[model samples]
Target: MIELQGVHKAFGPKRVLNGIDLTVPTGESMVIIGGSGTGKSVLIKCILGLIRHDAGQILLDGEDVTKAERDAFLARFGMLFQGGALFDSLTVWQNVAFRLLRGSLKRPKDEAREIAIEKLRRVGLKPDVADLFPAELSGGMQKRVGLARAIAAEPEIIFFDEPTTGLDPIMSGVINDLIREIVVEMGATAMTITHDMTSVRAIADKVAMLHDGVIQWTGPVSQLDESGDPYLDQFIHGRAEGPIEAVR
Candidate 1:
């Protein structure tokens, strides 16, 4: 569903993504694992056209993303940000229904709220919680609300940016299971960027390791531990030493 070919990006003297060739198949989950500053987020931004790449191509369904019509192109995607990124002023239901309340996907107020409530339920939240503000919810609850919002618009593609950030192990596990289940249930093409090995293991159908501004290794999740790339080995096992030098 998505493909990147010889992609390159940089900020003045610093290069981020270089020759990042990868693909995410339709209705499957691809998790990108990398050390901090490896440009995983930048690659996603480049694909979304949030940041223009210096060279090469990002294709969504065989068409170049840079040339696609902005509105219709973006409408096909949903994103769960690294931070919960909820509007503190808006109530949970309103936040979930943000897309449905405006732009091309707008719906009647009543219908939007109903869909919001249903999505909240799907993410394991009760109906009463919908009226509360984001501040009233716990971290995990906030994340669940974000997930509900991501799926509320029924996007064909979903991008999860560190889905389990800032949660306890149990809550992280819950979010991982929810992400895996929801992606499969909705059959949405999924691309996630996270350093968390546990999240990678739980949510990925395929794993790609990003290092030194390129895809160092990519293959089925089932073959992760046996892939035998030093960069990937050091990353997935959390080693302090390898090709990746830990900053002191």
Candidate 2:
């Protein structure tokens, strides 16, 4: 459902992405794994048009995203940001229903709240929790709230940025399972960028390792362990040395 061809992006003197070529098929979950500063998030932003690429093309469902209508094009996707990014001023339900309460997808307040509650339940949150604010929740709860919000609009595509970051092992496992379940249940195409290997194992149908600003390896998750690529092997095993240099 998404494709990037010869994509390149640079900021001033630094080159972040260099000719990235990758694809995510319809209803498939593709997880991108990479070292720090390898531009995983930048790749997603490029596709979303948040950071315009300097060259090449990004196509969504066969049409170039750069030429598409901004609002209408964006409505087809959802994002769960790295930090949860819930509104501090809004209640949990309000945060989840934010998109539904405004713009082309707007619904009546009561309707939006009901949908939010249902989404919360799907993410293993109780309706009672919906009335609480973000500050009152635990990290896991906040992540769930973010997940609920991402799926609230029933988007055809979803982007998960470091979904398991900053959570304990058990909580990370919960979030991984939740992400996998929701993506499959919704039958949506998913692209996730995360350094968490466990999250990649649990959530990805296919895995792509980004290095040196380009894809070094792309294959099914099952093949990751046996792929025999130095860069990928170093990353998945957390090796201190290989083709990838560990920063001191």
Q: TM-score for all predictions?
A: 0.98, 0.99
lDDT of 2 by residue, 1-248 (tens): 99999999999989999999999999999999999899999999999999999999999989999999999999999999998999999999999999999999999999999999999999999999999999999998999999999999999999999999999999999999999999999999999999999999999999999999899999999999999899999999998989898888
RMSD of each: 0.8, 0.7
Runs in model 1 deviating more than 4 A are none
lDDT of 1: 0.95
Quick one: RMSD of model 2?
A: 0.7
lDDT of 2 at 230: 90
Give per-residue lDDT, candidate 2, residue 47.
Answer: 94
Q: Which TM-score value belongs to model 2? A: 0.99
In Å, residue 119's CA in model 1 sits off its true spot by 0.4
- Residue ranges of candidate 2 with Cα displaced over 4 Å: none
Q: Encode model 1's per-residue lDDT on 1-248: one tens digit a residue.
A: 89999999999999998899999999989999998899999999999999999999999999999899999999999999988899999999999999999999999999999999999999999999999999999999999999999999999999999999899999999999999999999999999999888999999999999999999999999999999899899988888999899998
What is each predicted model's overall lDDT from 0 to 1? Answer: 0.95, 0.96
